[model samples]
Target: MHIYVYFIYLIKNIFILQYILEDKEINVFHKKEGNMEMNKPNILHIFVDQQRFDTIGALNNPIIKTPNINRLVKTGVAFTNAYAPSPVCVAARCSMIHGQYPANTGCFENDLMPLDNRQTLMDVLTKGGYRTHGIGKCHFTPDALALKGFQTREVQEELGVESVENYPYMEYLQEKGYKHLCEPNGVRGEMYYIPQPSQLPPEDHPSQWIGDRTVDFIKENGDNNEPWYLFSSFIHPHPPFAPPNPWHKLYRPSQMPLPNIPDEFESLHTFVNKCQNRYKYRDNGFDKNLIRTMKAYYYACISFVDYQIGRILDELEKTGNKNNTMIIFTADHGEHLGDYRCVGKRSMHDSCARIPLIIKQPGKFDGGVICEEAASLVDLAPTILGAAELKMETHNMDGVDLYSLIKGDITRKYVFGQLNYNGMDFIDADADFENYVTNKECKRAAFSTYMAANSDWKYFYSAPDNREFLFNKKYDPKETRNVVSNPFYKEELKNIKSSLINHLKECGETFGIEGSDWKAHKLPPFTKDPDRGLLIQDGYTPWVDTYIPGYTDL
Candidate 1:
């Protein structure tokens, strides 16, 4: 067993050796070396909301500074073309946790229950004896379902039941004396604009509270013997378009770079109508200055979130748990930020669906590995399960294990994504539920959309109307030109359209192997043992872990 030399000096206790070798060698001295086999390295998933693909410094965004995330990218694999199968929060998060597509999970929209009471990634890992904890914005189910895998939850608590309903991060901070972040004022209606932290103390901001809580949790639980899976979901870089004073001043509005927006961008798709409707309600319009200020604050929030991320990594290093910990950083979905004059997700455009996905697997995968192959958020669940040596079935799972992709095996030709095209689901829900749906069902139903891509040519298929978009990504990465009706690529369009239909059939109905591409992997039987917390607790966290660093001091 070759053990390349590296060392760790604990503040008060002992000196430990770090090794560079195969899994077998590490397993040999696992016990005596203080790195037990049973202590299988923990997974730390840091998810940010509404962050785009180019937001990270490592991705060549010289204008937007994100050093902490850049460091993660440098030390791991960055899936450059990663996208959410569904851009909305609930659908995306549900797919992420279950490794199933939104259509399959039935949590296809927000504020919905887990499909068929199915076990989640947390449930599976917890059942397999791993410690689990969750902190921050959980928008999927109601507060009732939010605490399923988490022992403690920090949610959106500052707003009223009508405003705050399922917002988890806000609740966590409001409970911890950070109430000013959500104070309603005359500047904007309640819940529309979360005012910049003018009246609040520094420590009262949501970001700062989340960071503080996470640090405290690490200090307390870093010494635990069992392996753990901790997920911290940040609400920032998700708008009211307000950053705390510190973050607001961190980036200059004039200096913030603007994303590419074609003058004729709105003409490309019918989804822009939805953007038009959303703008009428919020005062933050599509004007250049407003967008610039919003972008600056957004970048500042990104920087602020990065600082909090650094804090978690710093705490992990200080606690001597850094070596055996795997850090996975990504976002729920990307925001349009005025791209195509749209503010947020709910479309299949790059600005809305594309997100940053970086995985830093300590000692296993090296830093600075960039994978250009397409990937989905749903891939994260199975990838994590695979990393921990836990058994995970890909049955009914639409996402492939990303471990292989990270290792440089690029075999995929095309990646697929879709939004629901049915208003029936929306018409069936209550006002609260309807709010969570966000008119997605109606919009998608009004426009059944599908996007298919090869390495260069990308196709966007709009059914019923039969509108098509064909763009050469290599030539026009901005995706400006739509050559769908161009007589030159008729055969190519036919092939892509046929492929999309077949893919939809496979994804839609669980057809068998020759016809049913889905693998029938079974979820283990659910038991009603009261001690189920043993498994569920693998993802446990303290209340304060929801705060972000550099966002608080007052």
Candidate 2:
């Protein structure tokens, strides 16, 4: 009877052990499948306004001190050839968020905004259970209209006193007792290349403030179970050419190297010549000292921003979120920095269009890899969504996922950019309107510029005159000469033009020159309103037109 009792006890113990093991297995399955929400990676997107592709030391620039950015490059895949979809600030940023080219989004200029009804990257991420936050210059729309999808903490760089009030960065300046000196040299509209040190302390600079706020956000929410996406945008290394304190003195002007301006720059294109002339008259001259000083301040500003980036990265590491967070660093567009004797963007040159792009995803992708694939800022949205393992309707997006390119699943042959002079006022209306209306080349150069570039060749088409400029990029990387007139490259030019036309069709672009059989047709008419001028007239008045209702006959 005792032996029988021992056998029953042993059988009960086996059943209990089996029950416990099965229960643990069920719990493990729940954690893996049911709690997939907790497995999403955090995204930290760092954007610098008007930063060039060549500014980072890791990308072959030996002079600029971007140690923190170099650290990111060491742990990230740096795209050596990344172009901005639009060279202008608002258009480029709009392309970034919308995952479409400016042509598709109808945001071809600084003043234009993407349609509010259209879904953005932030909208997709927020819907996919990610907290979205924007810290600095979004420039998507005016300050009044908050971006539809994200909680924004803006730090705008407004010029006039009336406009400056209530701006986050301006308010910060007020608190720091430096509100009186907001604009460099007290100039408002165009003060980008002024070579004066900023009067405000380094701590109060916009770059530092942006970085500080980003760190705070990370620390407060890093441990939270929900995934987060933060856009840490900086406005520096862009304007006023003023770096504060030691940074201002960090790079001596005399030691800085000037951009190479070719002897044949005059014969390149009318637009290029116009830019040079505009700067020469506006800034007194593009003298050696002026160019060197601008370069010094620009480099110093980059280094300062790099320092702040280091602090933000340090915070991420301290919070133990480094391995789980994907860090992406890029810029809206690039600065001219005296390239072709120009000081700002709005050109089709590589200096104005190509930007730095770096992505760091620890334990998921190989570190210290350089991706030489041709990519654009428009690819950013799809890439972020892909990295988050989220799915959406990407049929409307013009760009492909960078991950696919990185994984060798896809390839990109050419990158495109658009320069629509929607809001630009290049001439006095009273003095220049007659010439603008009559001179085809002048009008075209002033109105629109379209670009298509691969690794070896680049093609630019000016809409107003239906003129084309082709460059052998491998030989003339600086774009000092227009080679369309050469017989040797005639076939290449024809092919590029055909490719651009096909791209326009793919993006559903109806504006500018409509083409067929490798030939251009009629040019799009210019309307009274510049923003709507590029749109083909179809007897429909734009809502922005300030005309009395039913007064069309007038």
Candidate 3:
């Protein structure tokens, strides 16, 4: 037993010793046999940032190609009604790990994270002897070298790593002299949604770097029989809408579908849309041709990530971990992709909240069945623990096992979400617009958006607006029309509102209630400082118009 080596590992990130410790040397790996395979299944959680639910090819969205994700859907159970815990990244991700709501984590925005002392899914699994390692982004704020129970991590955060010496991705870029081409998180500010190919080659792209690192990890640990958990997180399909080489030109922009701008619902009228419409997707200058151009790049980014997944899947098969591992794929939150004329996330709309969830474990369940039950990122902790045959140590988790939902042993009546919201998800705008969101009597400063949905209905309420929006998914799947004012659906609205209130109460949110009855109260004013993720570096130039004509218009 390498007891002394584990102490060394304890000092220097536990999973780095993953290469050193194997088998029962420290009891990290069980002796793999028939029964052991059933008992200790490996977990590989593939998480992407800002990917929308409708991008997968097999899922019936014709606009994009995602062959590898389609393979997962073909071989796994796909949850069609999955939603984010909250519509922003950090809130949704922290809630995911803790199996709690955003309010419980006190992270309605990216500014905060659950206290470090809190027991999370990764912590519990590590205690259960899983060798946990994280690659790519976690986006936990007050950015630490280690947070969220990942024994060791090679982060590719949108924000620059505080310790580039320790960050493997950054170090690699530096070593290869690709630092000049590295935008860290692609280009930011005005170019966030613009169509451009990455300056780096395909093999050197950040997504490719992650893919290679994961493949190498599998190769290094495959024969060790370690019951390992690897969070292979990717940073693509988020923004800058850039792909490298052939992928950038993989699609024709003219063929891409236009954004959903419903006539009945003016997106500009919403709080979030107003903040996002500043420059990247200005309402006046953003024509359908440019929207199509952006969609082409967006789809290209997703397809690039998909290719990386294919590499990981192939590696698992080569290492004979294919049947022994339980694979889970999901995103932190969905991207708006110009839905409702909004460029980025922080909306309660399906375009921003709904995500694709696929789980595959060999011989446990039927494949290719689209599980229609409501699911959220908050449910991942309990679900993954269930798959690993371990129990969650956290007492305040707010999720049920998704396997139960699929098997009909339990059902979720609705999936609910709330986000205090943000300023264009921390991207910059003109100074005047910034002042409006921060200092003025803007809607975002005063209201938080709350949402509740099931297969039958989608509901939203913004307190300061003193309005409610209800859309029947069956009749209006795109949520093009608000039926809250219609007398025909008054009873449904009443019942849905009652359900939402009870949910909030259950989650210990008393702010939305007044004496047992549901009531909307104007929230406290947003403070002057907003959490702009990864503050811009020095030598900033103003957003310049490229004047590149879209192929659709040409």
Please report how far candidate 1 places residue 118 from its true position, in Å.
Answer: 1.9
TM-score of 1: 0.77
Clashes of 2: 1
* Candidate 1 regions with alpha-carbon error over 4 angstroms: 1-35, 142-145, 157-159, 162-199, 272-286, 393-395, 408-410, 421-447, 463-466, 509-554
Best by TM-score: 3
User: Tens digits of per-residue lDDT for model 1 on 1-554?
Assistant: 12322222242223233332444223221322465555367788898888888788878888777878888888888888888877778778878888876656755455475635676788778878877877767665654335665555656422234333355444444566644332421122322323253344346555666787788778877877777788887777666556666667877767766656776775665433243223334323556665677788778778888889999989988987777777889997887776766665666677777889988775565557888888888788878888777755435566777877755664666666666544222122345544543655433434345666655667775442345678767877877778778888888777776676577666653221124222221212222332221211112112224356878654
User: What is candidate 2's local distance difference test score?
Assistant: 0.73
lDDT of 2 by residue, 67-110 (tens): 99999999889988888988888889988988888768777668
Best by lDDT: 3
lDDT for each of the candidates?
0.64, 0.73, 0.76
Instruction: Provide TM-scores for the models.
Output: 0.77, 0.81, 0.84
Model 1 RMSD to the real structure?
11.7
Superposed Cα deviation of residue 282, candidate 2 (Å): 3.7
Sort by TM-score, best first. Answer: 3, 2, 1
Q: Mind giving the per-residue lDDT tens digits that candidate 3 earns over 1-554?
A: 59998888697876666554432212133343433433577899999999988889999987688889998999989999899988888889888988988757777777678665888899988888888999988887766466577788887766454345767777777777653543655677656666788877898888998899899988877866458899999988888788888888899888887788888557324665555565343544557787788889889889999999999999999987886788899998887777776778877788988999999876553467798788999899998888777887656788888888887888767878877754444343556555545642253324567788887898887654556789889998998888888999988988888887788777677565666554543343322333333234322111222345886457
